[model samples]
Target: MKKWKIILLLAGVAVVALQITNPARTNPPVLHDLAATNPPPAEITALLRAACYDCHSHETKWPWYARIAPSSWLVVSDVNEGREHFNFSEWPTDPELVVKRLDRINEVLDYKEMPPKKYTLLHPEARLTEAQRKFIMDWADAAGKKTEATAPPK
Candidate 1:
């Protein structure tokens, strides 16, 4: 029993020390915000804000669990990956890039692969209704069409 207690105490100390290595999960100043550049319909904006912004934009609302050690590392890593794939904060003004992003958004939504299950489990608001998913997909398709129309031919 005494040996077990010592082992547990050392494990606890190691966990505490691990917190110091937590990655920085910050919301830096947004330069070219998507909403500011080309605003979407209000409902679409709201849906995106509730369901996608946490990981996809600079407006991430870090929850308390995100500040802890192991979870913090996972949260930060996910956020970084999310931003790398699609960041509405630094949304491209280039029409080709916009079309590409719109297509990717539609693809992800159609596959029901966004707002990863782990994320929605903790953040119910991030879960999209079927209607919301349709609206987002329709919007993406329409936006992609518009971008393509305006795109200069190579």
Candidate 2:
């Protein structure tokens, strides 16, 4: 019993020490938010904001767990990776690029590969119903076609 108590105390100290190395969580200024530049319909916009913004945009609403250690690392890493792949807050202005991004969004939605399970497990509000997913996918397809029409000929 005394040995177990010592082990627990050491584990607690290690966790506390790990907090000192927590990565910085930042919400940089929104230089070109997707909605501001090329607005989606109100419902689509709301869906995106709720289901996609935290990780995919610069408008992250850092949760309480994001301030802790190991979980913070995972949260910060996911946000960084998500933004790196496709940032709604730093949307591309080029028509072709915009079309490409929209297509990618549609593909992910079609595959049911977004608002990843890990994220939705924690942020239940980010979970999309089949109808919501279809709505966003349809919007993405329409947006891609619209942008493609405006893209310059290769």
Top TM-score prediction, candidate number:
2
TM per prediction:
0.90, 0.92
Candidate 2: stretches off by over 4 Å: 151-154
Report the C-alpha displacement of residue 47, candidate 1, in angstroms: 1.0
- What's the CA error at residue 106 for candidate 1, in Å? 0.6
Model 2 lDDT per residue over 3-100, tens place: 99999999999999999989999999998989764689999999999999999999999999999999999999999999999999999888877888
Tell me the spans in candidate 1 whose CA falls farther than 4 Å from its real position: 1-8, 151-154
| Cα distance off (Å), candidate 2, residue 16 | 1.1
> Model 1: per-residue lDDT, tens digit, 1-154?
6999999999999999999988998897787877764578999999888888889888999988788899899999999889888899998888888888888889998999997899899999889988999999998898889878888887
lDDT of each: 0.88, 0.91
